[model samples]
Every structure is written in structure tokens, then in C-alpha cells.
Target: MTETALLPGPAVVASPGDFPDWSQAASHAATRVPDAAVTATWRALNYLCAAQLYLNDNVLPARPLRVADVKEVPSGHWGVCPPVNFMLAHLGPLTAGRPPGSEVLVVHGAGHAGPSALAHAYLTKTLTLTGNGPGWSAADMRALAAGFPHTRAYGGEITPLIPGVRYTGGQLGPALAVAQGMVLDAPHRLVVALLGDGELETGAAAAAWTGQRALLGSGLHGAVLPVVLANGLRMGGPSILSGLDEDELRAYFTGLGYEPFLHDGSDVAGFRTVLAEVFARLRPLGVARPQPVLVLTMPKGATGPEQVAGRRIAGTPAVHKTPLKDPARNREEFAALAAWLASYEPAELFTDRGQPSDLVRQALPDPAPRPRPAPPVEPLTVRGEQAWPLVSAVIRERAAAGSFRLFSPDEAASNRLRLAVSGDGMPEWASEILNEEICHAWLQGYTETGRDALLATYEAFAAVNTSLLVQHLKHRSTRTVTGAGGLPNINYLITSLGWRNTYSHQNPGLVSAMLETENPTVHVFTPADTTRAAAILTVMLTGRDRANFLIADKHHTFTFPPDTIREELTNGAAIWPHLSNPGPGAPDLVLASAGDVAARELSAAADQIAAARPDTRIQYVHINDLTVLGQPDTWPAALPDDTFARLFPAGVPVLLATVTQAPAARALLAARGETARVRVVGYRDPGRPLPAADLLELCGMSATALTAQALSMVKEPR
Candidate 1:
């Protein structure tokens, strides 16, 4: 009995089949291929059919397409059919059986061939292709299409969508979000979802979880869905399910996610049969249960390890082989294409199909050169996505009620700092942070505006976490009433840094800290360097400080006359190689920050410093979290491998130097100094190290001998 079958929550493991693990599947795979002849023929046929189709569509020429040329066409190089095979297996045979007005859809995004061709052929009501010819290789698809009876869709745009069935394109990572929107918008249509191999592993999987929640909320249970997987190799990555650990698989699907129907791609006929069965089972009981059914296929001959043909064949580039194409691949693809299609007697196709054809010849709407530089989105630059009219309620909600409404700064200096250094984290704090980021992004839009401009204002405020440092300073400031009755420059201090997902935690601590703030400048810093300094300066001076942290590349370090800023250390702590920065009789406190100083160390050093500073509380404030500069990890290419297998929408780049990571700042600081210095804390905001009594009190603990004895801390507040 697997844990997934017994319990709920995220299960990291699962069985792959009736068996418990992959050893059984791998062994099963070894026996399925049976013989080499079948594998080779299947591979050849599949490739031949695909290459010819691509060439007829004016994709790769089938002869010599320069790697550069092959790369030119959008979504051309990713090899279509990975997402199409499953769709084709189910929808292909159905083309011949649709009663009048029983419309069908070929839904998918960029690069998918099977769905595109099938849909293209059927809508035109023509036999675009027939797998038969005089010198047929059985792999010939163009000749087959040459025999089709297809008619052009309205206005030759392949649209107005099937009146009954629609083929909508979607991007990767958020399928269910779209599904959610879709279900609400068109409550009458049958929504068939098609996703590729790695789709389930992405953030889009979150949508699946949400969909599950919606199903539960709507009181619809056991809603089965068919999630077909083109079980091709996991491109640029390893094979999924075909080789995943069983327990892991079971945990993932049966427990962590909604249960889905899984199937093999080669058994397309079988897949269709099961889907019909699953759909029939769900239709009557639906209160709108959103659980999806998943289908896995290995395309053609089950190219997965479970199947035979996809063996460890030598990695070789496949060029379309025809009498016209020499093995050298040095000839033009057109010659090869012509020779290949010639076998089918392609006479009319060259006439440019005076009637409707998928290839509309070079008679384009605009053949002139493109305009020089593209015009920009005007006025306020919007992030997230392109702009639309403000008529939508969703847009209104988004624009009006941001995740969190941020306090836009009035002064230039105060604006650039961030009040929340947020990301994935404990819930309350995460929400505050994520909300702040979203609100700031909305205010900033996409582009940076002027000194007092929208994004600029929020950005300025976001650049540094002023509220925190100001609050800390106020808490420690010799004068108890610096901003006595709510200061003019200060707005309500930020209390939480909301997160999107992953690390959400329900913590009452953050909220309590807010309630304890003695002044309007209170904030809890999340150790971002750039934003922290900006926050401090903003709260004190009522404006932002552009250069809070100095950014010096290794080479640029020597470029400064060595005295760009003078440094004079007064007193601090030392490193104990055996224990920590503070070992033996070392002083517990040190006041050091950024650039060769003891600033970016872990909290341990800061804690030691606070321990030593008794008269005042302490803080090892990580000022750098505010700094959004610096890079640590490389992108796995903006578009995932599976995203490339679409037909309408193409994969985008996850550009380098985007997305930031937490710095080993403290450790980096520790390594920089000959001796690690402990942080010194003085009286500050709730975040500062507090006395035993103070700590107990803030956490809602009682004071007194008995309570102290029970808690083990019966001393005065430090």
C-alpha cells in the first residue's frame, strides 16, 4: 500500500506500474523492442513522414538546411510531433467518422505537426494526404496530403474556430490558470487539455493543485481528466515517468496531485478508448470537478525504454534521404524535397494551388522591409504582460487591489527603497513581500519613470527597506521620541512580505512585531542590501539615496584610487577557528558593513554581537537584501524543453542575469576578513536581539519567579 493511496499532501514518490519501481519497467522495456528491423523501419517511417510534411509546409527543406537556417523558423528546430503524436493517435482516425456539424479541434501551441496537419486537412473537408503511391516508401506523407480533400477555413486565416470545437493555444507553466478562466468564460464547451512531458513538473503544476481545490470547493469530486503525454524522450533532460522511481511517481500523482489517467502514446487507439470511457464516467457527476486525466505515450513504437525502437542508437543528425539528396547533406533541401515528393507525382502543388492552400505563396500582405525600430508601449510601462483596455473586472481587481497596496513615496530619495525584501518564505511575511513586489511592479509598470514617476517612485522605495532600519534606529536612538506622534515623511510601516508559493508558513510572529512597533517607522528587514540602505536614508531624509551600496567588479576594484572611501575601525569581535566568528574570550559585538567589512555574514555572527551588547539590544542588519543587483544562477533557457514542441505559441528565452538568489553574503563577509567579526546590536525595533525578559514578553510570555523557573529564564529584561 503506497502512502499516496492512503494520505493527502505532497507525495514525493509513487509506483510506475502495477509493480513498485522502475527496475521492473526497465526490464519490461528490454523485452518490448523485440527486433532491430522493426525499430529501424519505424524510426525511418516516422522521420520520413515528418520531414516531408515539414518541407511541404516550407520548413526544413529536407536536403541541406543550414543549422542557422533550421534555427531561423520560429519553433522549427524543436522537432514537431512530440505533442502531436498523442493528439493524432486519438484524433487522426476520427477524421473519417464525424457526422455533419460534429466539429473537431486540433488544439496545441507552436511546432506540433500531427494536430496542425490533421486539423488543417479536415476543416477543408479534403483528403489532404493518403499513405499510398506507386513508389511509396510507406513513410511518404506529402504524397498522402497531395491526395487530400481539404478546404480553406474562412478568410484563409484558419480561424473563426470550429463553431463547436475550438483549438486554443496556451503557454507553459500555467495551464490550469487558463483552464480556470476558460471554464468560467465558456461553460458550454468540452475542454480537452493537451500538455507535453515536463509540464507537470513546472510551476504550472500549482495550477493543477488549485484546480483540485476548486473541484473540492465546488463539491464536485472524482472528476477524471485525460492528460495525454507525448511520452517522447525528455528533451534536454532525462526521461520522466518511463524511468522515475515508483514511490516517487506514486507520491507525486496519487498524493501530491489529482489522479489522472495515464496511457502509452503508441497505444493511441487505446488512449482514445480510455479517454472516451473516462469522459463518459465524469459527465453526469460533474458539479465541476477539475481533476484532470493524464495520458502518457511513447510516440510510434513506444520510443521509451519500455518500448523497443528507441535504443541507444548512435546520435546522428537525420537529413531527409531521397534519390535527390546525397548522403553528404551538401545539396540543397529543395532538390531533395522535389525528388522526395516527386515520387508522389506532385504536379498541381507547384501551380501554387490557384485555389486555397496552406502555403499562400509569396503573396504576403506586406512584402516591404520592416519599419526601423519598433515603437514602444506608451506612457507608463506595464509589466506582467501587454496592456488591454481597463474594462475587465479582473483587470480592475488587479489594478485597484494589488496583492498589497504600497505607500508610494512623495520625495525622490525615499521612493527607491523597498519596505519589504520578499520572496518565498513564511506565509504572513511572504504575502507582505509578494504583495509589495506586485504593487510596486504595478506602480512602476515595466519602465522606469522620472524622479517622481510611478515605477520610479515605488522602485525608489523598494530599492532599500527604510521602514525597518528607521524603526531599528528609532528603537536604538538615544532620544525615545524621535518621531513621537507619527512623523510627516513616514507612512504606515510594512508588516509582511508575502510569498507566491513553495515556502508559505503560518507565523503569528511577524504580525505581532507590527503590533509592537512604537512608532510609524517600524519594519522587519529581509536582509536585502540595496533596499536596506535606501530605506534608512529615505525615512530619515525624506528622499532616496541612489548609491547606497557600491558595486565594484573585481577589476574595477583596482580602478578606484584605493581611497574612494576611508575606513576606520574602532572596536569589534574576532574569529575562533574552532567555534565561530566569536570564540574563547572574544568580544561579542562588532560594527562592520559592506566591502571588506563584516556585513554579509549569517545570523550567527549577528546573534553573538547582540549577546555582547547588553545596555542596548542589537541587530546584524543585512543591508544588501535591498540590492537587487548581482547574479548567481544561470537560466535553464527561458523556455523549457517541452515548451518548444508547440505549434502556435513559441518558446521564449529565460534571459541570463534575470532572477536573483539569496547571497552567501554573511559567509562572503566572513571569508573576506582575516578574522570573522561578530555583529554588535544596540536598542532597535522588534527585530533586534532582545533581553530574555523582553523576548519572553514579546512572544507573549509571563514574568515572575515561578513562570521564569518554568521557562528557565528568570532575569531582568536585557
Candidate 2:
């Protein structure tokens, strides 16, 4: 292994004054890196990373050359490690001296490279281990090595278990958007998003490039340093981005409104110099809106084994995972693994006690505590029959508190959310983009980083971000299991129902997709009117660790007693006494609705039933929260058996009108063993360029259709 001499200098420490002024340091290149601490730290991280992947016992290898020391089932990706390690090592220096509020945050886009992050966390003393002996004892090291991919605290992916990992990149394309959100309104902080080349192919990633435009003129906001690790190959083969030349790549980013900086990873020292210069340039632009992107090209497995059995591994796809598959059984491969591990010279990096040496320790940043947002205030209360005015009032109140934002897919005005659009165009606190993926990701990023926000878009177009929503649900669920601190809910305002849209714009798949997750944190709320919608919105905005979907229509307006709003929200569903016939016994039929438009039709159907059959008993139920229809075991908000029985009698038949697909509502009802007695009328996607009533009638959701279904169900024998 080639060696670089360590330059002597003062020890690096975490303090506000330690950060260098790049503008002045650029003139003194020799003095810029007073020492080779970053390189030394990188070497130590590389050694620990290899240990996590290959060693199950004898982690420090005090005595080597034994098959028992090698893991029986060695696993983890190696292709993405070196670049990630390089970034992490350098970032330590850049972020070390920053104060509490201005600290730099990192989001790992290549989640498969978990070992690298785990190694860094261990070296920095930020990782929680079995025993707390300053996290440097031999026992702690052994425990970390034994845990490997199956650590009880965190799996082999970037998650909240690791400190500072706000955005989990299990799925690609949302990292950039999420990073943008972390810095939104946080002018002093900076987020460094390590984006992989393969992730660039996703539609969300493509849309995220243009997402910066939304932040350009939006007042003072923190900057996101997007570092693209272009390693030339993905899991399967060569990446599509690898085909572009340097000039072409520059043009691509330049067109997307970024000043692109291209660097070669082959020259580590040269790259570090360039990286320092980039940070220096960015330091003066604090709170200023200038999007700078850094493109770093390197080999797939830069510092790992280059070749084994005459097969090239380092730069090839073969090194994606466990380059030497069964090193313990194969003598040649075993020898190769030993040499690879020795290349980093663990003896030079770690003390005999299995702790990081002073050389490595001095290069690392102090473990800064994660920043927490201020506690949420009481939910805003707005009373009105107009949906936009009431919803807008809540939004305005949150914005005034300086901790809330609104993101829309350029449909805020079309959806009658004029409050989101200012006379000067998109405001600093509110952004309107044309891509739903970006809008959803931005809100997710904002909320996960300790603030509240909402994404408002047409219900049909909301499906565009179904994948993003599911990813977030999984992310939040994992956070809950790990006991991470609470984060505000991801609130979505779903509007422009299919009943009012053309065939091309008619799909309620977003709701169905969310329901399919069966995640306890997923809450689908369908408020009946503007008053109810406002109430639901306020509750969701102030809640935590949930993904709340508030479905309501802005085109129509209806008034309900403001006093009853709390009861409806609490019960999820409640009887609308005014809309039902006076009765004390079990009703012949129950009329229920779970959406605004569906509620209107159901109300009209109730009038028809009451007028035609004054002698027949009837009851009306308005469902403000749809999850209550599910079994209590699956969703916490789901009504218990007794409550469900009381609201929906066992003997009486029920006719439900919902905006979601009928099958979805049926599935929820099936959980309660009530599917047989319930008749559902909902969107079947039989939409067209017709009037609202015509569309509803075509889908069997019209008031006349609902009335007929109710009458027929009541006539059936119990």
C-alpha cells in the first residue's frame, strides 16, 4: 500500500471559530490543510468499514490467519463505500467548527452503503453500543463488528437510528428534494446530500433538478450542497449518466440553474483542495440563493480489492457486493481479503485497545446533538362555510408563526387555494412547482426536519407521488420503532375529486395506495364540508409521527355546526342527527359518507329516503376520518367493536358513499366483518368530460343511485 506522510499542525476541534475562510485560504494553498488529519481519518474509517463487512470475530485481528475470524455470511455493498467515506471524512473538517444552530447536516442518498456510515458513527463516538465505556473499549468494538448487517438498533440501511440521518434513501430520487426541504427557511444551516449516479435516472430525481428554481427567489433559505458521486456503474451495469462527457454533464447541470464543479477522485489530494475551494466560495453566499453542484467521478470500489482470480473487481460491477463471496472457504480469495484489509493498516489507525488513535481522533468532529424545532402551538380554529377561506386562515396562522410552509404542484390557484399564491407569484413560505413528486418530497423533508408543512394538489395527480408517500410512511414507522424524537405530520390537501375532473384527470389511486400500506401512522381523513375540513387540517398540522391526508373539495361549500367539529374528529365518524329521522331503536337502514362530494350526494339521498318513507326508521353517519372503518388492531384510530356496533348496528344495513374506490372502502369494512351488510357507492374511474352530476351518475355515486341502493337494502330481510 502506498503511504502519505502526515503533516504536523494544531489539533482540529469543534468550535465556531475553527472553520477556515476559504477566500483567504485559497491564496495560501500550502497553509490550507495545516495537517493531513482528514486523510488519516479517512484511512481509519476505511479499515472499520471493512471490519464491519468481513469480520465477525477477532475484529482488531490481534492474531490473524484463521477462518473463524471471517464472517460465516459476509455481506454489504462495497462499490459505494469509498466515495461515501471520502465525503464523510472531508465533511467532518468542513462542519466541525460550526456552532449549534449553524451545524451542517448530511443525507445519504446511497442507502446501501450503510457500513460506511456505521463506521463513521462509531469512530466519532456517536453510535450507541451495548456498553457505554466511552464507545472505545475492546468490548464495544467487538459488539459493533458482531452486529454487522443485523444490528438491532439499525439495519443495513440509512435510517433515523443513525444520528443526523434525516432522509432515508431506501428508494432513490427523493434525496435532493428532501435536502432542499431541510434547508428551507434555515438560513444558517447547510445540508450536504450525497447523491448517487444511478439515482439520477428516476423521475423524482429528474424533477428535483428543477426544484431549485422554486427556492431561487424565495427569500433567505439555507443552501444544499448536492455532491453527485458519479462512479460510472449502477448495480446491473453502466449508468446512463456515464455516457455523458464532462462538457455535456456541465451543460446539463448549467441548464438546471446550478454552477457545476467537476472533480477527479483519482487524485485525492487534488480533490480535497478543490472541495475546500468550493466550500470557501459557498461560505460568503450564506442565506443567498445560489445553487452549486459538485460532481465527483471515481472508481466503483476505489480502495478495495482490485482483482482476484484474474477477474477485475474494483471498477467493475463485480464489486457491488462481497467481491470475494466465500473468502473463508477459498484460499486464494481469503489471501486477497487479508491483503485488502491490511492495505488500510489498522494498526496505524486504531490503538491496541481497539479505539481510534489520537491521529484519527483529532481529525473527527465532536458529536453535536441533533437540533429540535420548537414545540407546536395549539391548532388554529377557523369557522366558515367556504373551504378556501377557512383552510387559508389556518395556513396563514401557521406561516405567521414562522415554522410552517405550503408546497403545491402549480395547481394551488386552480384548486381555489389562492392563499398559497401571492400577487408577486410564489411566496417564500409557499412554493408551487409543476411536479407532484417534488412537492411531496419537499413537504416530507420540511416536516421530518422539525417543522410543519402541507402539499396541496389535485386528487388525481396526487397518485404521482404514491411511491414517495409509501417510502415516507415506512420511514416514519421505522423512526417510531427506534424511539427517535417526534416529527410533525406530513399533511396533504387532496382536492379536485374525479367527480369534477375529466377522464384523464380521474383517479383516486393515491388514497387506495396509502390504505394498502396498513401502516398505523397512515391516516386518511375525508372531512364532509369546509368547517369539518378546517378542523381536521388543524389537528393534523399540530400532530406528530403521522402521514395525514385531508380530502375535501374547494369548488363546493357547506356549513356544519362548529361545536360538533371536535366530536366528529375525535370519533372519526359520527351520526348527523339533523339529517336522520327521529328514532331510538335500531334503524331499518344507515346512510354513511366519507367524502365531501359523497357527503353531499348522501345528504340528498337521505332527504329522498326521509320524504318517501317517513314511517321507516333511518340514521345518517358522517365519516370525518376514514381509517375508523378499519379494525382497531390495524389502525389506532379505528373504532373498537363496541363503538362500531353502536354507530353501525349489527342488524341494520348500511349504504356508504365514498370518494375512494368502492373496493378500498369494502376492504376496510371487511376488517370489521361488516362487508356483507354494507353496500358501497364510490368512484369506479368511469369518468368523462361531463358535468359533475353526469360524472357521478355514470359512476353510480349520484344521489338517485344512493337513494335506490338504500331503499333496496332496507327491503332485504336481515
Candidate 3:
């Protein structure tokens, strides 16, 4: 075996003599050789999968199986392994002829089947060839086997740690949506998302089927190949789709704008033939209009042990994980595990060096190199005083460049942002779906692939996609550790806050949920005015590898000086000198506010407080980014202790008004070890519809309440 020199960074370019052009030869050989090579590869993958879960040593057993070879605590799912392995085997040959500069990315919806991904990665030499892990030799295989579920080199599920895996679908339902986003506007890319039938029950997955409707008029090139790995069992019981026959399954998918292709795995050769044909038809540039879906139905735990301890396991949920619970301690279970491991005949598929044999090697495709990012585009020239206008300007520029998209849950007009239109009078670069999950998925997928996108939704409803956002945060974090180039930030324009909305539309939990993560990459920007919102929006668009939540108001609000807001954006918070009384070392009180509406009330309170007590020295501080209030160790954007002291002097009574729950601000302050006597006022949700001002008054966020609170705090003894 030759050592393949990997590129310096995440991008792995192939060297001259690294990978032989085996596609042509393999294509010609396929005419005469029955699908034996593919079968061999699949068998090898199955053996590796089982080995990862059960074996701690003797990876390629040459003697009689013994209990010493089994792991003390075998773990990992087995039900979805065989089918995933089967798909990888067929995909290798099918993707061999893909055009240059194209990619065949796979998203494992059933992420619990991590063993399958690891096995495939090892077999194809992806881990070694790409420099993501150790070399694919006998020693490395033994080390990997010993590591089992605790390897630092790989995660427990499909993760960025794996060379070929991009999206981690441990939280089911986003796989299809993420895949759709990846293929949007990318014509040469073919993203195959392997989804379990159980995952289809998720609301996100159910809504993802309608994503095609959003891309109908958009002249994008790439297509998603949804491969439904129907094993007929969920985590605990039979899957809902298991009751549907072939005809029903076809109709179900066909109704959702897909050309459905059903493959019954009973006949391996027949299924392989159909899979190859489908791949060939969908790999072309323009053939993915309607998109293609392959519903491959196989039994759960297809090639694993059929029975353990005299209980049927295969085709049942019992085989979901570690079919033989204690293979190392129980003699009967150990024998069954040994038989299962022997069924794949590891000796025939691997050489004495533990490397994949010639037959298995010939069946896998060369690992695709990571795509280099497109050259940086010039920053868009945006000019506006209002939040919506500023956001719209950025959108228009992105739409014109054909690289920016906006996914909104039918709130573009409501948010006062004009949707861009193409020459054909259709919405261009803007997709409006009523489902927040779908909108979030599209934006996530698009941005993760290096494109720019933003998801706009009402503030109250933004929490609906909190789970998706968290998953993406984890994905970006893992990708960063892998040295993969930074992806565009996942930006969410959270507008129409609960302050001005009716009873049912009042909720600020999204802001709190994101703040709770305390993730360095999570930023919550609560710009005090429209000018600040525009400046922050521009920065958010250009930022990388962070999740930004921009909470603003669509209605006309106060405007601040552009330069002042620019400076505020940089420091995350700044004292408005013009709105405060200039005095000595420390002011008698510090009045702080975040959010446009909250700032308006604070500004009014400052004027009243000044008139009432002319001699009282007061400082007005406007917080543009809420994350800055936290400790710098937890959030990079957090204000430093020195800067914080300068803006918020010690022992100065501070009255803070925010748009989110009061506890959120208190938590950040506590994290920063702030000793200032501070009283926080924010949304408490009156629980029913009321006038905006009345609601603010009830929540103790009105100007009168803030003024009274500030006066009492200032009058109190130091």
C-alpha cells in the first residue's frame, strides 16, 4: 500500500499516482463479472460493522472464536447497519462515473448506525487517505476495534469526525430537509439522504417533502436522492410505514413530487441493478427536475443474528442495539455473536494485513475531495435606516449575485421585507413556506454547504425550530474541530416580537433557549434601533460558523446615528454620551437597555429622570448584542471586565430593560460576576391580548416603571 499525501488543510486534493482511474476498467469488467465484487464489498462492510460493536481484539480472527475476542460491553445499533452497508456498496459503483467537480454526499438519517459509516470509511480508505484518522492497515484496524464506542478519532453517531459524513441526523427528521438545502442551486452535486421509515413520522420530515415546491421556479441544478431505508421498525415498535404495501408507498411519495423507485432487498442482484440504473439517470445535470426517490425495503437487522438466547432478533426491534447483550460473559450469547461474525466470512474480504482485498477495493469509489470554497465576493453595499429595508437591501444584493437565499415562513410582507422577484415574475432567492421546520432546514442546508442564507420568522414562533438550531450548532462546532473551512453563519431574523402581538403570539422563549447554550458561537443580537439592526445584519451575513439571532421590530422605530451604532456594534455595548449627563469618575446610576422597543422606553425614562433630578449624574448604555453581557470565557463577544467596568461602573445602581425574560439578563450578569445592584425588567407575558403599551406597563418595562425603579435604586444608601 502506498502512502497518500493529504493536502495541508481540510481540502484533500488527489496526487498524480494516488488513485488509479478504476471507473473505466470497472465499468468494462462489470459486463462479464456478475455483481460479485459489490457483494464482496457489502459482506466486508457487514463484518466490519459487527466487529466494531462486539470485538475488542483479534479484529480479523484467524482461529476459533473465543470470549476474549468479544468486548466487555458491546454497544451500537445493528438494525440499520446491513441496509446502510448495502447502499454504500451500490453507491460506490454508481458514483464512479460522476463528472469532475461534482460530489456524491451522503446524509445518514439513521445516525445511530455509526458503525456502518466507520466501516465504509475504513474500507474506502477515506479515513487514512484524507488524513482524518490512522492508515488503513492491520495495526490501525486493531486499534480501531479496541477503541469501540469510545474512540477519540470518531463520534458515536454519523459526525463530522467521519470523512464522508456531513450532516449528523441523531435527532431525526432534518436529514431530508438538509439534503434538499445542499442541492439547492448546485447542479452537479447529488446528495443521497438515507432515512429510516421511523424518521418519516417526524413533523420536520413530513414538512420536508414540500421543499420541492419552494425550488420549483428557481433554476438550481443539484438534486437530492432520498433513499428510504424501510426496515419496518421504529425505536420501540413497528413503524407506521410498515403497514403500507409497495403500491401505497409509491403513491405516498409520488404525491409529494418524486419519481418513486421501490427495491425489495430479497433479491440482492436485482436490487443492485435497479440502484445502478436509478443512480445513472439522476446523476446528470438537468435530469433532477422531479427528483428521484428509492424506497428500499429490507428486514430490520438484515444480516445480523436472527436469534439470540432462543429469542428471534432479526426483523424485530430487539436487534436495535447489541442483539447479544453480553457476548463476552454469557456463553450462549458469545456463541451466537461468533456465528454472526462468521456469517460475513471476514477472511475472504480482507487480506492478512487487514486491508480490504482486491475484490472489495475494486467495488468502492475514490473518496471525493472536499470542495474548495468559492472566491470571496465583494461585500454588498447596503443603505437604510429601518430594519426591514436594510435586510431587504442585503437580500436584493444576494439574490442578484445568485448566492443568497431567504427562507421565511410566510412573514416577508409582515416583517416589511420585500421579496425579490426574477425576470419571470416569480419569487427569486426567497422561499415562503408556512412550516418553520422546513424553513430552518433549508437555510441550515444551504449555509452548511458554504452558501449564504437567512431564516425569518416571528419571534414567538422561532422556538419551534430550537432543536434544529441546536443540532446545527453542534454540527458547526464539530466541523470547526475537523479544520473544515468555516461555513456561513446560520442567521435568523426574529421579528414581530411578542411585545406588539396578540395573546397567542407572545413568547420570548427562543431568546432564552439560545442563551442557555452558552456556546461561544451562539450570538443574540438585540439592536437598540433600526440603524443598529442594519449594521448588525451586515455583520451577521459576513460572519462564519456562528448561529446569530437578530431580534428586531418591523414597525417604524427610533433611529440612532450610524457611526454611534457602528461603534456600539464593535463593542457590543456603548454609552450614549449625548443621552447622559457628563460627570466625574463614576455616574450615580447606569441605565441600560436592549432591543428597539426597550430602548425607546429607556430613552424616555432617561429624559424624565434628568428633569426630575438635575444634579444626579446618569449614564445611558445601549446593549446591541446580548451575548456580550455574559462572561468572555463563555462567549468570545462578551464585554471584557475592563470595558464592562467603564460602561457600568462598580456600585452604581443599574436599571436594565430588555425584550426577553428578566431571568435571561440576570443569568448573564451572574455569569460575569457583576456586583452592581441591578434590577432587570422584561417580558412576563400578560397571558392575554392587550395594547402594546399596556402590556409593557404590566411587565414593568414601561418608561414610568423604569424611571421609578431607577429613582428608588439611586436614592437607596450605597
lDDT tens digits by residue: candidate 2, 311-423: 87877788788788888898888999899888888888888787898777766766665444556667676654365677877777677777788999988778776564346
Ranking by TM-score: 3, 2, 1
- The sequence of per-residue lDDT tens digits that candidate 3 reaches over residues 283-367 is 3222335667899887878888777767888877787887888878888888888888888888899987888888887778765
Backbone collision tally, model 1: 103
Error of 1 at 410 (Å): 28
Please give the ranking of all candidate structures by lDDT, highest first, separated by commas: 3, 2, 1
Error of 3 at 395 (Å): 2.2
Better of 1 and 2 by TM-score: 2
lDDT, candidates in the order shown: 0.27, 0.76, 0.77
TM-score computed on alpha carbons, candidate 1: 0.33
User: Which candidate has the top score in lDDT?
Assistant: 3
Clashing pairs in 2: none
Give the distance in Å from residue 13's predicted Cα in candidate 1 to where it truly belongs. Answer: 42
For each of the candidates, the C-alpha root-mean-square deviation to the true structure, in angstroms, is: 22.2, 4.7, 4.5
